[model samples]
Target: MNRPRLAVGATLACAGLLAVGCSSPSQQAAPAEQAATVNVALSDAGCSPTPATVPSGPVTFAVTNSGSAAVTEAELQAAGKILGEKENITQGLNGTFALRLEPGTYSVYCPGGQKDTWTFTVTGTGPAAPTAAPDTNVADATTKYHDYVVSEVNLLQPATKTFTDAVRAGDMAKAEAAFGAAREHYESIEPVAESFGDLDPDIDARADDVDDPAKWTGFHRIEKALWQDRSLAGMAPIADKLDADIATLKANVATATYQPAQLANGASDLLTEVSTSKVTGEEDRYSHTDLWDFAANIAGARTAFELLMPALQAKDADLAQQTEARFVDVTQQLARFKQGDGYVDYSTVGDADRRTLANSVNALAEPLSQVAGKVV
Candidate 1:
């Protein structure tokens, strides 16, 4: 029987998101006193009121769960801007979209292609803020990094499939060969494992050998299992369990329970890392680990912005205010990464190849945090 490789990257993306997304702002109103409220529903049918609009500057969205099945999450968008989204919708029968928004065009969207179809607008003198420029250089580098990681992650999928096919076909040797191919991919990325540490600790935590390898224990163990020369003695039973677990995980991926508020409450690990990524002096060169943290923080801030857009549109002062405050907090946390000297060295430093890890860390976090705080 073939042993399955783990979809560790999926968890990596999620783990990073959870680390950062769990820190949404406390409930607060927008600066404008009377924020409007819009109540909506999500279902296999569609979002009602094909086209919708609301006055801007602090709006509140009260979403009611009238559908037969439960709605796990909600989002608001307009002009490529994510206005608001709530992942904490456990009210089996009753739920509310409590959020604040700013003046702008908006739409209430849902995950898994459950778009609201209707378009909405929030009109008013919204909060004044400056524009944010995507750090193209940083983005390009990060994109390359993400692609490399994704490729390695994707490579395991085929190997896993091969293992499954072999097991189902009763071909242990073929399963072992597929496992070998997968292991090659893992070895290719081992030198850079430190870079993936924050994004994928599960795979990183595994031992370096085949026999006595950690069994397919979710992301890390399964991933490590894929790379080993199939321990036929050990791999057979593990393959049986993996085949079952994959089905369960895929089934739950879509309608899975999401707790944004709960997630928001547990962001200290990533947030603390963001806050502490400060640069110290001329030694400002950064490692892949710093960049990984940088990407996670940026993604988190972006998620928060999208989560709050709807509330801003509804003129939900408290919701908008709270989101803004969270943004502020996240940004402030990021700011600690910036240098007190107002300059960054994108290149390496010193004849001895010493790096000013502190300063570069601060530099990466500061601008991103500023962008997150200001990008409405």
Candidate 2:
């Protein structure tokens, strides 16, 4: 998040006024102690606190997970010191952490920079304890869904891996057959996607409309857009539209904002990689058929999110909003990673690249699921 610039006042009149006040002593009042509770969650960018407010003195933070993501822990930190933390927190929906705290400013943080953070200020005296919301029953919900997605991914993995391996081996026939089978498997889950939207849109989109057939194009929409015979001639136009959509989507999704120069720097580098890097295909990768470019893109995004996480933990919404812009950029490019470096055809890429892409996509499922789960 952006840090506020401190200004020094050195006017003679101002100095004289300060001196007068200092010279005149008055009764001092002791700072009052208060109590409060803060709710926190993990995100792709940083930790997030619901309500963003805490009472003074001996405050208890109750961190809760209301979605289908695995969050191992939530921690409270300040001044580079770890104040308190709850580990082995529940995953999926309804997991929580309760922390007792003294009145002060605290940062709520989660590992992996995958959650938003908040800085809560506790002032004078605790209020009467408020009743807690009943658990959302997220643990049970997460178990059921996690098992389902795992099963689906397992069923599709073999065929997809085969297609990717065939591509790497330059076996066109095998690649074609494997690609078709993988597509069918992914399509089969469309009806179940709606249930996973809270975890990952790609999966949710799949499960929501498998019956549509027209909608069950699998990953080909992006693949064809980037690698089809005519796609290159129109790369600029398509990339332009894609970039525009990314900006719009980021704007739609922004929920916080904070100090941005550093964030902007990271975002600039990320965008450059997308627009000029080999994986985005501005550079030739045929001579170097490795999928490192795709991997780098994912790493860059994860880095940007990490850089912005601290600010998010401070509850700097403005910072979160700005960082999210970059987040969207990275994720959008990631979604298209399959197309870069000739991996779109599924048969043209190696098994390793395919697996890497799948893992990257899967990591996003939980956070996206949580975002979608929020009514807002």
Candidate No. with top lDDT: 1
Local accuracy of candidate 1 as per-residue lDDT tens digits, 1-376: 0111122221111222211111112312223345456766666554552326665434445555554353444555433322234433434543333333445444555533244345566555644232333223222322343344346545645655676667556565665444434333433333123122122233323333123444323233433333343334444555555545434322322222222221121121233333333122211121112333343434443443344344333434454455455555545544544454221232333323223343433344333222222211
Q: Please give the lDDT score for candidate 2.
A: 0.36
lDDT of 2 by residue, 189-234 (tens): 3212211112112321222224453433323322343334323332
What CA RMSD would you report for each candidate?
17.0, 20.3
Which one wins on TM-score? 1
lDDT scores for all predictions?
A: 0.37, 0.36
